[model samples]
Target: MNPGLHPSKVTAQFEPLIAAFPDWHWEIRNLTIEGDYLALHLRVTGTHRGTFQGVEPTGCRVTTSQFTLYHLVDGKFADVWDLVDTNSVIEQIEQGKAVL
Candidate 1:
């Protein structure tokens, strides 16, 4: 999560992406749990149907990776760290290729 942004504002950031990739889907590639921590590796797939990141829709399919870690306290999330490969997604979209 970005330090400057509130957690509640995080979901709003995805609204543009949701509109751009209406059919986007996430697939869990790996999941692990250790003590109070949970980690996940995910693959995301979608088609560029609307503008995103200042790029106009090209109707190209795109795939990207995301990794996330969560710290649990009393069975609830206390902290979260997340990463997404936005560069790869942009490159694929610009090249008009589907990396899937």
Candidate 2:
């Protein structure tokens, strides 16, 4: 639930992430809504233009896929869970695996 990846939960925590990836974009490829549960398939694209998780900027472009599930309560978001393919993104930035 921490948007900025901080251990502590805080609102607007994604500000640092926005600074780190100024051009970051999360595109939803698929979505399914059933009752109070919503599922999202996404592709996240960005450039490592600033520091993240203490890792210095690499200026590398990264693309990663993720699946997220959100629980709704009274038409508002209550809880969220995500499954991201972080290894693929790391390989792109560090090992030059994918060519996108």
Candidate 3:
């Protein structure tokens, strides 16, 4: 789904996840910039405390990694691409791993 340039649409995509992971935190692991392009590596952690996509809270401490690339034009973001390790999140919830 393309969230496009609309702020509400962009917020909609994460509203549920945010509600589900109220204590979520994103830690930037690495960042690199060259000209108009930028890349980032991050570690995200949170506790499952609310429903996400109909999946009930597992009360598990979830940790996942993500990578993102951005292209800027005139100092404004022109494009963005990302990769998130969602499998790790699913696995932790499915495996019944409790708080860390």
Best by lDDT: 1
Residue-level lDDT of model 3, residues 4-57, one tens digit each, is 335665689778778999998889999999997899999999998887656688
Q: lDDT of each model, Cα atoms only?
A: 0.86, 0.77, 0.80
> Mind giving the per-residue lDDT tens digits that candidate 2 earns over 10-79?
3375688678879989999999999989999999998978877666778888888889998877766777
Runs in model 3 deviating more than 4 A are 1-6, 98-100
Report the lDDT of model 3 for residue 2. Answer: 30
Task: Arrange candidates, best lDDT first.
Answer: 1, 3, 2
Count of clashing residue pairs in every prediction: 0, 0, 0
Model 1 regions more than 4 Å off: 1-10
Report the C-alpha displacement of residue 68, candidate 1, in angstroms. Answer: 0.7
Q: What is the TM-score (0 to 1) of candidate 3?
A: 0.83
In model 3, what is the error at residue 21, expressed in angstroms?
0.9
Residue pairs that clash (backbone atoms under 3 angstroms), model 1: none
